[model samples]
Target: MQNDASTHPEGPAASDTPATPDAPVAAFPTTRAKGCPFDPPAELTRLREERPLTRLRYPDGHVGWLATGHAAVRAILGDVRFSSRYELAHVPFDTGFTGELPPAPTGDMTGIDAPEHTRYRRLLAGKFTVRRMRLLTERVEQITTEHLDAMERRGPVVDLMEAYARPIPALMICELLGVPYADQDMFQRHVATSMTLSSSEEERAAAMVAIDEYMRKLVMGKRTTPTDDLLGDLTTSDLTDDELTGIGGFLLGAGLDTTANMIAFGTFALLSNPDQLAALRAEPGLVDQAVEELMRYATIAQTGLRAALEDVEVEGRLIRKGESVALSMEAANRDPARFPDPDRLDLRRKATGHLGFGHGIHQCLGQQLARVEMRVAFPALLTRFPTLRLAAAPEDVPLREGMNIYGVHELPVTWGEAGGA
Candidate 1:
């Protein structure tokens, strides 16, 4: 909505620290309260309400602006004046990480600015076009059906995260990358290890190396004997062996983690809100809307980081050059100004313009595929198990609190045998 920061409601000042007369500042990375796991940190909400573009003290001791308002967040992300160079930006939060960030790895687009980013984005863009992704609809449906059938055969109670959520995306990504079924377990092992927040830096680094080595070998195989998949098709392109390997690893990691989390988290959100779950079951047509709403409500990709490449005035605040800015997607998506009754998970709500997939040039490249997967998966799960409900208490559901991605670590669920549709 409103882009003018001055016009935003100025509530009480943030309590992180005292603000000087010249610069309004607060600490970055507020913690989410225990009972309010689904909601953004209360401090973020307060900062957004009082001063959406206030100064933040990064963990690395860099003071930069934190954009929590929907408009401010979008404005920063859309503006190329901001940098996405991973080494240039500080996370300003607990990552068990310290010291300066390393330069953007060979093919990780998340850590680079444009020109280079533009090149990779352009090369891969054609593969993810809406039409191409839509073509996968039948395949997605088949995949969803197979998983549901397996669940039916095996379950009275099960960890849906393992049985349903994790595998769907993992399998889809494997198919897309043309990874052999025989090697999927190995591929998936490295991926899971690399993404674990609890893993030591050395462990994570080793996992990445293993993943890259495998990708390099996979790319070489595709070069000699191509197949009909994203990676195989890319072999025809002029990309170098190393570049192809990097891109392959990047896509596999991105495609698998985010969507898998959304599926598990979406199920948790709906189960917690029985009325919304019922609405989806009663009206299967609501699946599309529910997907967007759940993405908005879950806001799984909690925050985005950027550094000002040059001084720029945004949302009426002056952000100096070289300062890292953190955009709180979770907060902005739930901003009351943008979405009324933002906390309520109304499946019927026309939740357009959500930052769930983000916005701007670096917005998720695999969004269409993720949407198609969700559009099919969510409804199918509900339809297959009408009486599906959580077996664990809501509070006991383990969440990935300190992880880079926000989601449940596991979701135990059960359903009546006769409830299948």
Candidate 2:
């Protein structure tokens, strides 16, 4: 299937003189201000305003394009001409060690271009259809209630990230992949450590091998017993053991980390905006729109990397073949032309073309599952507790700095004992 990319008109005219080719080179992966935890790095936002498509110098000293505008980023994601091949792309910000890149591991659809990606996506597509996701709603509601109950039992005050945020997606993905909930901690720890950018190469490699081994075991089990779950469903397909294992690893890590952060960050964003929180509480019907607005407002996955397969023209700029491009999804979602008053957190706004779940063939496969989780969980937490607020001072909530995934490291929260609506 041809996934449609977000198509929005170009934003206001480029600033006078445009980021003069003489403009001082700003490092990629710029830092966000502590005071403005919800905003993208000021430098990145400024880059968008000044010249959405400008030069980006990678750590290895390769100068490429950075697409911060809605149109430009979407164009890159939707176009097959830009390669997602693992070895060809440049790491946007890291200044650490360098070497030749290996091909994307089996089943990692994001790392490969067409044909292969098309095959994996086609096989997995039926498993996450809209109907199937909606059918999982009752179970999601049950899971949310169970966690909320646990929080109420252990609370008044708790780290929502630990007690609420991470486990919901963790358990859901485990259930989908036929992973035993008892073993969730093992894979959870591995996935978490793997996401830490500061981790040493040895540490990252170890985590990858550990998770892959665990998935290998699960895939072998499915082959023998073939219980009814996503992994089991795949066991009947023509995929090899390596491919099955890789798919399991990809699905679990992707489903868990991204959705977990979204839940936590979305909660933090809503809590910081009391009026927005109240509006959501008062009007239950607004859940779907509110989810989209929150996603656009606080995109958890910060950036995506793509390398040019061939020279391409994007928004009047000529990107040469083999040059890397960083698609700043955070900035694209906030482009003024796409979203008026782009910085404001307005739940009622029509955030139709936001790049939060991404766009094109690589657009998140499990987005509907995420939407269902948030749509059910958010309201359930607020309505059940009636008095939910942050336990720590807003400024003191530890942010996950320098990580690919953006979110609060710990969300200390308190709520009244009352459980009734």
Candidate 3:
């Protein structure tokens, strides 16, 4: 697998506007606006307003399309004419991998198209269905409760990130994949090394090699032992040991980090938006909508890329073959055409159909699992500590930088005492 990423490809909106020659090529956004941690970069909003689908200049000097309008982005994501294959793509923003990208490795479904992708998707779909994810809710709650109990015992002051947010999804994914929870620390270390732009190519390769070997061992073990996890269940399928290993590694990495960020970053968003928080606390049933709003509001998996396989028109603009389109999921989520009063953090809004998880076929495979985790975990955290507030000022909390996923490095939180939700 090239890299584990979150992608949502859905339908297009009719309002995709054409770009004019004099219009400046949109640059990939790097900074959030001052004082508003929840909103997309101002430049993104401007571009979305002026040219929903505009020219984007990549660092490698390739001129491509930037799809910021909600409709256009969803349309592009859903249209099979745009290939998700890495070999066909150009880096929308410079996150190190430049020039012509290598074809996706075997079993990395995100970077491939059509028949191969269909096969992997077909095999894994049943395991992550809504019914299956709903079943995991009880397990998610147990894991969440364990962490919350730990945090309360430790003290009022804690980095809720490490204490509460990170562990819940990690435990769930580990259990589902039949990976020993004892080895999560090791998995995290290698996964971290593999993801960061600063890590040397050798380090990244070594990390992959280590992960590949470990997964292969796990697959081999499952083959002989046939335990009761996702991997164990898949062992009965016709997939070869190599294919299963690749998938196991992919699922293991893809499952945790994004949901973990949603928990931490979603909390930061709620704390920052007190009115929304108060409203939810007053009526805990809104947790479902609250989770949806938070997904739209925080949008942890911020950006995605796809390339055109054939000449096709999206909105009013023609996308020539071989050209890439850099999708701003954050900007699309905030599109006023699709979302009323787009910038506000209103938990009461029906925030379903959000591109925060992308749309169409490649939409996040574990999104159901994520929603279940967040729906249970967020209310539990809020209820357990009604007075929960950020220990450090929101501005002081360091945001995850240069990474594909958006979140805080740590969330220092404190509460006065237990109270009713």
Candidate 4:
């Protein structure tokens, strides 16, 4: 999550430094070119091209591996020899070396590999199927329209992040998880704290405590009186309340921040590329491909981390036991071999294999829901306001450079009038 400007300059001149065994390579970079915020950092791209699997120096000064190429990234993620266990992972952050990492908390599926992970996945996968998510489309459309209506009434300009991007997913996820949407501010604040790199350890601990306490109470309510929601539906299962609390907390945090950023970042990408925007607005049928391309183009969940359980040969390179590999989905999505003219945002391109939702067993569980939100929200926003455009200059818009998720903190957008370009 470090974007050392001095170490990583903006532009084509970024990755001049070589990645020798002794030299530490940045796991994921926020130092992307200032001129075009959509592209991955030039240094990262150069490394991907030069050495897809190469040596990386961790903040703890231990050496690991960095996976940049699409093939190598997928291999690392899919291979069972590599472990996703939290204790096995080498911390990838820039500061405060925590030499010994803690084990994944109970029900933190992403942190633990199967068959424990299998249990959670099996329990929840049925609920997140395409048909189930699509069933909520009407509600999603209503949410999108309501927000757009608010924006229309508010006038020529508004902060789309707070107004539209954040609320829709917050509401839907709360409904699905049975968390009270009225308490969104508490969880949203927790997400904000965790995503911001500048947040102190104390702040993060407090945020975790707040969200954990809230989830525990919410789970108790589900146990006492089962409602009609994802959490409520799971009350009959044999899983303990502790496990349920962990799962709910994990799902709530995972579902909220991701789709919210996808909306904000996807919109930013569209507004930045007017040609694509024009294409989308002109052809309503292109929504599916547009959403896929945007997911590939602005891979907000930038990096995937895992450590080797044993020596494994991946993409002709050996990753030894206990070594961490930082999978740069941002760089991998933009790999020319996987995506022709990778830098260009071509909506028509078949971005099927892109690492947008990630790959292998741990791919995004809520991708269907995220897709529903984007597919519903984007076109409707464009069609509703033909004149929708960035209210501020491109360079002036705030980017979440320091955080793990890539997006704008606030997107100030404006239109000529309701239904006018």
TM-scores for every predicted model: 0.92, 0.93, 0.92, 0.92
Q: Model 4 segments beyond 4 Å from truth?
A: 1-29, 417-421
Query: Candidate 3: lDDT of 240?
Result: 90
Per-residue lDDT over 311-406 for candidate 1, one digit per residue giving the tens place of the 0 to 100 score:
688877777666677889999999889999998999999999999988999899999999999999998999898889988788999997766678
**Model 2 misplacement above 4 A:** 1-24, 417-421
- Candidate 2 on 203-273: residue-level lDDT in tens? 87799899999999888988999898999999999999999999899899887788888898899999999
Candidate 1 error regions (>4 Å)? 1-26, 417-421
Please, what are the lDDT tens digits per residue for candidate 3 over residues 1-421?
A: 1342222223332122333355437567667777777788898998899978988876666677888999999999999998888766667666565445466766777788898888899999998999989988888889989898998888778998899888999999998889998888798778777766667667988998899999999899889999988999999998998889988988887776788888999999999889988988888899989988889978877777887777789998888767778888999999999999988999999998898788888988998999899999998999998899988878899887667677887999989854321
Give Cα distance to truth, residue 80, candidate 4, Å.
1.3
Ranking by TM-score: 2, 3, 4, 1
What does candidate 4's lDDT look like per residue over 243-269, in tens digits?
A: 998889889987888899899989999
Model 2 root-mean-square deviation: 6.0
lDDT of each: 0.81, 0.82, 0.82, 0.82
Compute the lDDT of residue 217 as modeled in candidate 4: 93
Clashing pairs in 1: none
By summed lDDT, the worst window of 10 consecutive residues in model 3 runs over: 7-16
